[model samples]
Target: MKKRRIDIVPLTDQALALLEAIKPYSGHREYVFPADRNPRTHCNSLTTNMALTRMGLEGRLVSHGMRSMASTTLNEHG
Candidate 1:
């Protein structure tokens, strides 16, 4: 058996603004970051990892680490 859970992350004004800025590029598509080969599908799961790697953060941090840090910071502030 597995446990399932849902998390609601509140977006900040800046985040909303960024989304609005990106709307023109992706609003017509189903995914905000659509696959390069298939607009109907989302980007690959490793997309964030690849980005981190490109930024020379391969060993220092990963996508989940970024999420965990954000969660921790938000929880601490709230």
Candidate 2:
């Protein structure tokens, strides 16, 4: 195996706390967003929907829109 450098993205305190709280509920997985009523797999659609709903942008923005915004913001900062 070849050694390679990996860049680390820093998480905020709140993010860390949320992950810590979800740790026990995850059983033995590293995913923070597991499928509802089942911890075996991730539910991408459900996660996106719930997130947009909570942000009050359910009808206004989709997951792709959020990704575009994030990319634009990072590019602007960089």
Candidate 3:
């Protein structure tokens, strides 16, 4: 495996905070999500999504989804 370059530096403190919250384990080389606690089964952010869905906000869009939703709006209005 080879190290890959990240194109842009984290622009905001919030962005850095999120990255720090999901620290990667050197062994796995991936972000540590809640579902990854049990290595026997592989799970991603779906666990988080399922939790949110239970709150009646399922499919209401998330942080990443919001970014996608807002980028175009911001670009258009800015």
Candidate that would win on lDDT = 1
Clashing pairs in 2: none
The order by descending lDDT is: 1, 2, 3
When summed lDDT is taken over every stretch of 10 residues in candidate 3, the lowest stretch is 26-35
For all candidates in order, the CA lDDT equals: 0.86, 0.80, 0.62
Model 2 misplacement above 4 A = 1-28, 50-56
Choose 1 or 2, whichever is better by lDDT: 1
Minimal lDDT window, size 10, model 2: 1-10
**Residue range 1-78, candidate 3, lDDT tens digits:** 236855665468887776676665423444344345665454665665666778788667565676677898889998
- For 1-78, candidate 1 gives per-residue lDDT tens digits of 134666668999999898878977874687889877787898887989999999999899999999999999989999
The candidate, 2 or 3, that scores higher on TM-score is: 2
Candidate 1 regions with alpha-carbon error over 4 angstroms: 1-18
lDDT of 2 by residue, 1-78 (tens): 235767677998998898888898777575676777676877676689687889899789888888899999989999
User: What lDDT score goes with residue 23 in model 1?
Assistant: 75
Output the lDDT of residue 13, model 1: 100
